[model samples]
Target chain A: MKETLLPSSIKNKEKRSAVHAKLKQQKKVEKKRNQKVREAAEKKALELGEDPPPKKTPRTIENTRELDETVCKPDDEELFAGNDADEFSSILKQECIPKILITTSRFHSSRGPDFIEDLRSIIPNAHYYKRGTYDLKKIVEYAKKKDFTSVIVVHTNRREPDALLIIGIPNGPTAHFKLSKLVLRKDIKNHGNPTSHQPELVLNNFTTRLGHRVGRLIQSLFPQDPHFNGRRVVTFHNQRDFVFFRHHRYIFETKESKTPEGKDKKENKAARPGKVVARLQECGPRFTLKLTSLQNGTFDTQGGEYEWVHKPEMDTSRRRFFL
Target chain B: MPRTTTVESPGCPPLRALTFDSLGLVKVIEAHDGQDGGAVKMVERWGDPDSSKCVLAASILDRESDPLVSVARKCGSIEVISAINGDLRAQIPNHGDEDDAITGLHLFSKQQSESSSRACKLFTCTTKGHARMESIELGGTVAEFVRDPSPTVWDVCGSGNILCSKIDGNENYALFGGKGVEVNLWDLQKCVKIWTAKCPPKNTLGIFTPTWFTSATFLSKDDHRKFVAGTNSHQVRLYDISAQRRPVISVDFRETPIKAVCEDIDGNTIYIGNGSGDLASIDMRTGKLLGCFIGKCSGGIKSIARHPQLPVIASCGLDSYLRIWDIQSRQLLSAVFLKQHLTSVVFDSHFRKEVPVPEVTNTVEEAEVIETPAKRKKGFKDEHTSKKKKSKRSSKKRLSDDED
Candidate 1:
């Protein structure tokens, strides 16, 4: 057996254990004294018919630590709870026409005039505003006066139209997108006639981290409340993280009348009379957007590295839309 | 140790203001005049010197009469100490729960009766959205507790949602901000909420929410119904309870979140401080950035207090330095290292005569001497000796100024 070198080792276990026992006894005595003092205070308070003073909780250093952790966790269900899909979809019944005002930066290249003309062909209701005093407040004021639902601001950097900032009227959920490819309607010669139907909006494969931001930006670009007179129906769908966008016309039509059977006649007699029913009809001029890449905080459609996957087949009635 | 030796030999000016920091130390500093850096003397130090209980908020009560400094600690204990002697007058334990740190301390006077004198009421709010009002009699008896109902919306956030505010003249109104909740004006007299301005929805896509307000102040004496808030979103928002529910004015100031905000005496200018140590003055009417005050503040500023009758503002924060800046010139006048992270500062506005005028010639000579490297090396030793003599002479002069 090895000899214990230290004085406070197991060789002197009895002494060490005795010291520990002494400490334990002292602690017990202290605790009892504290309890007695507290009881005495409480009894005195009771005699006086007053509440005893609240006990002082011991101070801890953790109290000074920063408490905010809600900003990082976006998946918190409570934050997403109030977003009612029905309430949002109800906007389609209110605003159908998408009247847009196009305003480019004052310091743009010669290509700006030609681009504006091309945009007018694609969006017939779009109006061009000569950029003069490019202040956000002034621009918003002008757009309000013109009664435009959305204001599209084309920002130029180094003589290149590199970004598009879209702000909805009245109150904003503003969206900024990167402009790329610069393809005009005339450049795609094989493309069908412009007057054949309404432009189809196709938003494709915007699913990555950067893609989600772009997708949300595009979604907010549309007005929160739709104009029913415009007969516009905007669709946003995501499948396996690939978001898709389409804009089409929708009209409400009265369903055809049919003679009631014996069981239906009994139910009809019990129910209130004269309820008008309408069915939704989807129409033409669809726009398609294929989001290929994101650069400089904007959606870029020209990047060729985008991985194209076959569109998933599903019943339209059974499919759920993301936005 | 002799009291005079400990108190007087440091050659610092007399104390005109008191502040408490997160280290649980209370320091009494001399107030600065409008020109530049003034003398800061730690005349009396109190509380747990080892910093066992971090001081969260502090306010000086009855500055015009019986001056008392009330400090709220992180452990939910509130201690009132004398401003002159640092004697503990009253200690209330468990004023709030341990998990809920006190966020603000406001002192207001309320008339108790027709025959009795006015009593000082201390209103405190905790991170847990608990608000309590306690009436303290002249004899240091603390009683008459009034607590507001816990805001149900903030229940899930717990201590993450902190509330801070300033009390109105009669202690009848409190304007406070809650994280991700709303800015609410409460009627403390009736213990009811008056109105609420909901926080704007964040613009981020499913992540990176905007920060809540860290500090706020009423716009001015003329418009008590409106207030300005410095938010973690790096924006200054002005809300008028009389107007619409949304903010009346919103302007982005900087990239870093704003930590402190105060309105100027005229109410047309707003002073703001950010977490990155940038202090700026903004024109409230035009919404234009006036200028930034350059200082040696490496850490975030926690509190900003302007002089009652001067163009100077004093600020203290994590850098452990109390800095005085001239709002007109945008120059740092003085910086005093207190060796503790300061959380709150309150000026003794009643002690008006204690302010010291800036010594222009002395600073100009020092600047010139620093420019010449050859002369600086030779004058370094002489400068130290002269500085000590000047400090002694200035201390005597400061005493005379106080007499005036």
Candidate 2:
């Protein structure tokens, strides 16, 4: 009768209950196995000094197709902010002197040759190139061979210098800017003459639109000297969106020796030279430039569409001096 | 292997546009045999907009007799065009939201029997964490669309995730990795999670942070259980399904991030291209750099595709040039200035060659030599040493042959 009952236990209801119990037991075993795996993973993560493993969410078809806007929106915002900050930070750390080449359009030369002379006085080290025809390829090749750091091409329309095309050397970013209200410093304002002391430069208030390229251009105009021996320091300050260029020179003077003991005392004091021993002179050629517009990629200024706008001011309180 | 000559075209078509905005357009140039010379002509160009919406991902559907090319746009549209001539066959607009960009597109055939009704499946994933699988019949019409239930937690922007692999020789699985450390594998047939592999955290400043994978591919057709990935931190990692949570093998390749990666036909070598326009072939077993293909790329390489049956590789990138190179010789065979930045390229496996027109009697011999049994055996024993000797011998033979 027990055997009959045991066989009858395989009846549909009884069989279903037995199968359910078996499944429950199987699930329990699986839970234990997963617990073991989780513990092991946690221990491994601890050993590596990492955060615990993320919770394993069961994969579902609905979850995979669900569009989560909140998660991606923050990431996009963060990426944009990060890129802008990185570009600014990288531009600030650059320090190199630029070798500039200045060229004028044929229209500018036809208008007057005095503009070239005036530009030469402002940037003494810039090499002047005569404009014959507008061949960008030939000019770029020539600039490369001359090892110029930057090329400043002035374009004139109807006898008025209208725009400036600045191209960096060896495939750097090119920028175009419209020039307005040109003024040449005719009178040599007698601030003072430079002596034999080293000088320092301060470029203040320049906006950060193409600030790095502009800063590089200004720095390259100066000589690459240690300034231990007296060197001229130029400062470019942009106020009211106009770049004001200033130059200063300092001369170091040695004290007269009274006796051998006095000379020894002077030598000991040489390491901490004060302002009493150095004299600063402001050399005049100060000028201001109003950058009307800026655009990326090379522009001919003669051909193609020209769209110029006044450059907006950037916060310059953080960047007081660019040396 | 048979040596096939690529005939040169007499006169190339003028590139109508040179603006950088044209980078958004995708063109496929077809070479047709001509009487005097073979003319390579643009068969189709998709996306004629001057706006900034670019192609994010594209896949060539080569399963059927007539292949189709599906391109995913940044504006959340998928366009299917005929491979023969650029004609819109089907278009799926608004696959994702306007702001949501599709990161990956893959085409694979279902494992169902021919009698059971075979159809091609198109799988797409977006940066918004959406994965959708659509079934398309042989005539380029959508039959059904199924979306996966479980989405990945990782951000898929810029990182190349959403890859399809054949699992257990029959079942198809899609693998996705993102900014998160975990890589999820999903069974496409059941639309359920199969397994997950957790990538090891990057050790930065004594802190463990997740490293995102930029590109990934299965090791080979035979070794479907294992896959390789290139990370944003310039690491090449290998993961095995049967292995533990961590990647089985990892190696640092370069300082710049890797943008594109592809495996050789035999699966023993991996070709990787980084952001600095550098392409290198790496040995899988020893994790050693075999050689770098020099002087071809001038910008970041966006994609690399290997020929289905030939020892040729086609690479296109931000440099706006499509270059074909010989894998063994590491020599640039041909280059075409496409005048626009190319994000991806795929060869038509069913491309038929026209009858060779007898124009010039002295035809340039195509250099497509297959390795013989004896040479292959010699190659197996100390490959590096044999390769050096072979190169030296080839140079000397070429010199003598030229003199003769």
Candidate 3:
């Protein structure tokens, strides 16, 4: 009746590969024919005043994520009330300007300072301090006395910048993040230089309660009033609980049309003239951050209470995300 | 594999608890297991509007009358509110400045209060060793709240901050411990020190272990001499005053310091939660770790309270979620996100007073999984004989080693 033996079952290797390739090509042609037939059917149905077939959505980790109860809902009175009294409320309300003090761990690495230098260029009113055998607790005390609103500590291991600690001033809710995939400004191609004006902050995919708190913490590192004229933007995009940091500058450009040698280009231009398009040129220093722990108070490892701790067991499901 | 229990099972009631947040917000949470998953919700909320006046410590005084919640503010003020309605029953203004914040608040009834059985005394202690006790009665038909009279104040002789203070079941002794402070047991009747925990000897590095006790609790409900204290160095020390001044058994937990410790109703087991959200149960008899509780908490556990009757415990923390866990299964039963960093939590034993028969029957049925009385008796007998034989063998081995 039909040849039941498959190409993979062929005894000769050369013959098996040849048959396999031929079968693949035949299958490709068949798929195209079936796609055409389906499209024609859909087109004919539309022309006959009938609805087209429904679109099939592709399955993805984000779309098929487990249901999370902590996802923030709009018009939640309790969440709003809690946010109003949070530690970053003053900075978020624009009542106080955020003055950040950035430093590295006790043992310094070459790349750590370079990363801090790039960070200083991005954050306004940020000053870098050299860590020289000074205890973090002592530095926190000093920063509090000096009226610094926040402290950022970069920790390096094996000559690579690995961890970041951000502590809110006076009172705290310290956050520790594992940093990776760092690309400096000089390494990125076609990267633009950042302007002195405060860049606008965009937090994306921060839907859960913990994500909202982390978003607010990152937001407090920058000034509340942004200069739109600068066209510079800093975005913290969270996907699968990894926060990707990106800086970009945007520009508006006019759309251009291409015409055939003998075609009438005027008709194409008359339909839509000067269609404007926005383009972004990235300013470098790209990185990814995964939160490790969130402490309730300042960076006191011995006694401070952590609000959340990342453990190996927490990664039970690939689709389960905290942020 | 965790079974989510439902309150729909005729006589089973939902777990009711009170939680306090960092901004002085108090919420009453109710939770039950549903077919789909655990369903937890906040039923009531009330607290000081001034966010600066953070809540430090809180306790629920549940007696024959309506339960009262005592919330101690960071500014040293204590507010007593009706647990049922969140109505302020009494407000005691700040006793001292902000630095002298209240560290402990305990409410207990005195034996001499038989004349006014509803009257309970509130014990409050501050970081500066100031202790005060005031009688408060919330049983009256008065429309307006009455102000409490002047309290009897004393000083606890301690060198450093008294971070925690807890009273024994009989209300005869109070245990005080804190940063740089050793565990001290004081007789509530005489107000004199009964026992003091000695400092542990030096370690291998010739360094003395710091005496910073973050949390302490009694090993048993009635035994004041057997105490368990957790230190800031991630060590849990069990002390039996009748045995020795030093700890009989000391075990190290995970890296982070232990923030909260609670004894199980069984008295042989203790649940200790550390700053890093690790909740583990240890058998106090042998100081061996039992399995850790399932369902990890995201934040440092601040308070753990065992239900007076149920085989469950409720724990809340800076993560702001109130979680109820079944003690026998060591599995999380239900969790409610409170939306604020919770500072403390307490179970409402008298949440619904309509039915008592079903609850009494439930305790026995649930305990069947662990063991029945007859089964336990046979097992105990076997264990006793085995233990005696093992002790004799160990002594003989010790003697041989000594001779060699």
Candidate 4:
């Protein structure tokens, strides 16, 4: 202290000058530029009738002098790698068994003949028989004629977790569905060709979801009417939408280009399901399923694809022998 | 959630907190499909039972200790029924477990199966209406009870013998009622009797289309032998069952004429629920108004009964709500809205095991869930026609036996 740097301030100034002499003058010019920017911002705020001030930031202590990428890299990369591997496995191994359907009563409303049109509201792909029906039934006959293992009623119901049935087979994936509480009054008894074979699955969980659905359906018939309990379920949502009646199941591919041409000009239209949509799983309490080897696009209408089957007993996928 | 309701489990999700204006005593609830569907409302019929989820029309869910079994009132009469007919369920818990883990020890083992032929005889009443005093199995399959063609044989009342047929057990005693009063005793063998005193009436018959008396009971104190018919009107008549042709009490309700009456429990108490959801409890001794409960219901009040263990009065209405009221506290204990209409109410307190009976609120779901053990087909098989012949031999005998 006695030998005191002849005025520590003078000594510090000399040190700064020596360091500054080697550096370019741009550092000083940059500082002036930053000051100008700050002034301009403050001036703008004042003009706008606002208050502007420098913000205070809390200081944080730095623990380590340097980062070690090796410490965090391996586990994180492995986690990401694992995720990618799972996604690949799930996608490739995914397969689904046939679906189980629970058909409700088909009695038309007392309102009369026009009620058939109402049927379309509930049955997405209703097959009419004059031209469509006879053939459909014939197909069922063909299945039974071939002595297929069993028949299946394909439909939907509401039960959580399995909101949609047939999520997937032991390794296969199933179709997707969106379910509503409304009950549908559909008579599907005469649709399939006369087949004598019993169905692969008989769904008994019909009453719960069907009652809910029918309750909804009955309510729909008389919108303003109260339910059997004198209570009405009324909840509105922005995205609530009903399925578009798919009167024809033939528009396998061309349907994807439905949006206006310009909405997404760059969209790659090639990947659509045109008969092979990547469906999401939905309601599934009454679902029954079986494994078959038929590829996408064409499905057995009667749910009888005998040629494609898995014989767990034989531990093999054996093709059905057609006479 | 709307299947069956009790104190611990209220059937319906709470309605919108902003309650709406209700009409009369009954209020209706309606809901449409998602955002764009229709609605269905329950209608209340006065006097007759509401058959929605008609398990009991019998009685609404109560605070009784039993599980899945409800005791509903037929006017003042009590009868019991299981909430889930396990014989009708595929995954019946009481049907026992399917231990599929035999593993390496028993490699070729098959799932063992059992027949429910005997269990089918548990949950039904053989006789439907007035009956001639004949010995019959009381609570069993509905199929075993034969509907007697004789006019006075139960359910055939309108067809014939209301006097000789209406009685409990195969005893030679008969129970009848009067106008605004209670039940009377008559002898099945002797045809008529004399009673001691008269009690008050409680309900009307809606489905049977008769003056189905209410609050009628035979006290063990000597049976209807000690009690007499009550008449609240001038046109009313009374009979002394213990004696012959003696009138104990004659009463009337209207100046014109009151026909019959009945009592609930043992004539000590009686309950009467009206169309407007009004339930009145009366003290049988003096016919005094013990208490009255007023609540809004959408269906007609068909039947009502007191909780066997709780201070609740259960009522069934055409509105599909099996409602329980805390008569002492004058509060609504609970309401179970059914998807189906109710036609009758009987109370039975037999303990039913705990089981997840499927949805009663869903008409479809209920039917679907009960697909288990459904009736066998009456038709034939296409394959192995020879086997069909064998099946025919057995199945034909079954239909005639009517064991199903």
Please give the C-alpha DockQ score of model 1: 0.01
Question: Residue B388's C-alpha lDDT in candidate 3?
Answer: 56
User: Per-residue lDDT of B1-404 in model 1, one digit per residue for the tens?
Assistant: 11122111112122266677756778877643332324555555665453446788888764443467788887788877666556666666874356877887876655545563434566778786777776654433334322223322212123447656777644567777757656778777677777877656656665655447677888775566878887776888888888877788888976666878878888778889876567899887777899988653545677888776667788887556777777788777656666556788877655533223258756655454333211211222344454654343433343343233
Candidate 3 clashing pairs, residues 3+ apart or interchain: A307-B299, A308-B298
CAPRI band of model 3? Answer: acceptable
List model 2 lDDT by residue over B313-365, tens digit each: 77777555676667887766556656445678887654544345355621421
Error of 3 at A243 (Å): 0.9
> Candidate 4, residues A1-323: lDDT per residue as tens digits?
52333333445777757555534365688889988988999999889989986754643222211221112233444323322322123322323112222212122223222232333222222322222233423434543344321222233222211122121212221222333333222332222221222111111211221122212222222123222232112221111112211111111223455556764634646555333443221111111122222211123222111111222332211221100
* DockQ, all models: 0.01, 0.01, 0.39, 0.01
Interface C-alpha root-mean-square deviation of candidate 2: 22.0
User: Model 4, which residues run further than 4 Å from truth?
Assistant: A1-323, B1-130, B136-172, B177-184, B188-267, B352-404
**TM-score-sorted candidate list, best first:** 3, 2, 1, 4
Looking at candidate 2 chain B, the ten consecutive residues that score lowest on lDDT are B368-377
Residue-level lDDT of model 1, residues A202-226, one tens digit each, is 4454433234444544543444443
lDDT tens per residue, model 2, A86-190: 212232333444567888776575433555555554454577888778576578678878777667777788876666667766454355555565543344555
By lDDT, the candidates rank as: 3, 1, 2, 4
